[model samples]
Target: MADASPKHDVFQAIADPTRRQLLKLLVDKEMAVTVISGHFPMSRTAVSKHLRILSDAGLVRERKVGRETRYSLQPEPLLELKRWLSYYERFWENKLNVLKHLVEIDSETGTDRTGPNRLKDDQTPD
Candidate 1:
């Protein structure tokens, strides 16, 4: 059976490079699809598809003004992604701190944890 979950979650929506770029473009100001399509080499329809995915993910909002449709970034959904990544960031920070402590210990003991070094352990007396 196919997955019943949404195919266009914020994580999946931002996974595409094109969609990420589109978000970056929308960050500064709201813009019409025509203006956005001009920034990319692909046809407007292709850009629209990406926008649709972004919309599905709740990462983009649309407004109709006169005859034109304007798109803007909706950043609230990204807080979920940010919270998820922040956990990994703490994990990595702890790992890096442990690595730093190990390196400091190695440096103080004059021992190379990275195997034999030519100038130290591997040097031969001439």
Candidate 2:
């Protein structure tokens, strides 16, 4: 995986729910392609293609041991994704703060969130 940026095709690769599930499966343990394929309904070739994209993304480490190739998760790229998600979390926090002001909560939790009123307040009036 020479491409260092995770935004382009690699993000597209993980946008598919199936591909995301495959990554989760590899998280806990290294698995063989055959074993990984068995978890999904797709054909071996389709699974292989997904694996290739993941490898390109620097997400999976593919190793050849004699007759079979095994794959393990390389979590560094996922750290990038996590960092990206944290930014969204900050956005959510800001939105929550704005709502906090709108609602006039004196004892606020420092977020737009407050009790059951939150659900009704967030609704669009239209």
Candidate 3:
């Protein structure tokens, strides 16, 4: 049986710098493949390939206007990535808060929690 999975996920789609720039270009306006290709150094075919990946990821929507094919950004799929990253953001925040508290304690006690300057509780200077 054929694989039912999408050809590209949002992570894979945006993994390439070119594809990320393409999405940025389409954020405010849709453009035909020709116009989109003009913004990059690559050929139109290359741009189309990037668009295809974005389309597979549901990160872009394409429309046919007569002979031209125009593409636009579809940001809904990116919510998954945002949600995933937000969890790590909170994790880092907690770590940073702990470090901040350690720094504050070290300053008040005239001790260093890091490097060779760290001192034990009984080693305070006179």
Candidate 4:
């Protein structure tokens, strides 16, 4: 089962595409806003919004160096996403295995029933 946790600021942070890209950028190495913004076609302000989300999620951190604020990746929160995805991995694997077995059986029998096994007219809906 998934962790039935309360609302986490981090979870929503990664849900956005822009924020995900920002996180990916930081994953490589620490960089200033100027450097990070260079990778995107959008304005620096837009990139800044993405960085803000990452910061709130604890996925990135900014440090003050002179007049610059350098951003670095924070990996601890990402482990949560990994764990959540891992839970579904087993469930999907089981479901896919069942499907594969059914497909293999159909192939061996020279029968192909890709949709409902029984015709809709053959049975009444429950």
Candidate 5:
């Protein structure tokens, strides 16, 4: 039986700026390779390679229309990236909460926020 799994993960596919731009282009509507290539400075073959990576990662869908192949965004795989990032969101929220508490304490105590710990005008750090 043929393997049904994606050859590349969403994270790997979107690691490149070119591939990310390709995803953005297809988000609104599908486009043929020739049309898509016009948006970037690279050759059509280069754009096609990026599309192939996105397709391998299951982040894009391609269809043949006569002699041309059209590509569209397949956002389902991005859910994995979303879930991974959501996990870190809580970590950042906790840090923000701690900073808020410290600021509240400083306000209550009338502590100089611009004290020795902070940099002064014309003071450059090493």
Candidate 6:
């Protein structure tokens, strides 16, 4: 039987900026490597390497079309990433809520609850 697990980690595959852009390019349509490479400053071989990593991570789907290969986004794998990030949503919400409360207090009392060192909107760090 074939292994169900991906050869590469989704996080690792997307860690590189180039690979992330590759995913974005393929999001709307399938593309040949030559076409995809045109969007980057790198050589076609470098872009192909990035695509291979994405393919290993199951973030992209590849197929043969006549004499060329085509690639497209396979977003099902990203649900794992989404579910992992969702767990931290509550932490951010709590922090934002505390900041909101502090801002409200600052407005009422005419004081800076954010911190003593925070620069005002009109001020810049020097």
Best candidate per lDDT, number? 5
Total residue pair clashes for candidate 4:
0
**Which regions of candidate 2 are displaced past 4 Å?**
1-9, 95-126
What TM-score, to 2 decimals, does candidate 3 have? 0.75
Using TM-score as the measure, the top candidate is 6
lDDT of each: 0.88, 0.79, 0.88, 0.80, 0.89, 0.88
The parts of candidate 5 lying over 4 Å away from their true place are: 102-112, 117-126
Off by over 4 Å in 4: 1-8, 106-111, 114-126
lDDT (tens digit, per residue) of candidate 6 on 10-104: 99999999999899889899999989999999999999999999999999999999999999999998999999999999988976776676667
Could you tell which candidate, 5 or 6, scores higher by TM-score?
6
Question: lDDT value for candidate 1?
Answer: 0.88
Kindly report which residue stretches of model 1 are placed more than 4 angstroms away from their true locations once superposed: 1-7, 102-126
In model 6, state the lDDT of residue 8. Answer: 96
Per-residue lDDT of 121 in model 3: 48
Q: How high is the lDDT of residue 6 in model 3?
A: 67
How many backbone clashes can be found in candidate 2? Answer: 1
Model 2 lDDT per residue over 12-119, tens place: 768988889989999999999999999999999999988888887888889998889899988777777787898789878977877666556445545444565455
Q: What is the number of backbone collisions in each predicted candidate, taken in the order shown? A: 0, 1, 0, 0, 0, 0
Q: Which of the two, 1 or 5, has more TM-score?
A: 5
Candidate 4 vs candidate 5: the lDDT winner is 5
- Steric clash pairs (candidate 3): none
Residue 100 error for model 6, in Å?
A: 1.2
State which candidate, 2 or 4, has the greater TM-score: 4
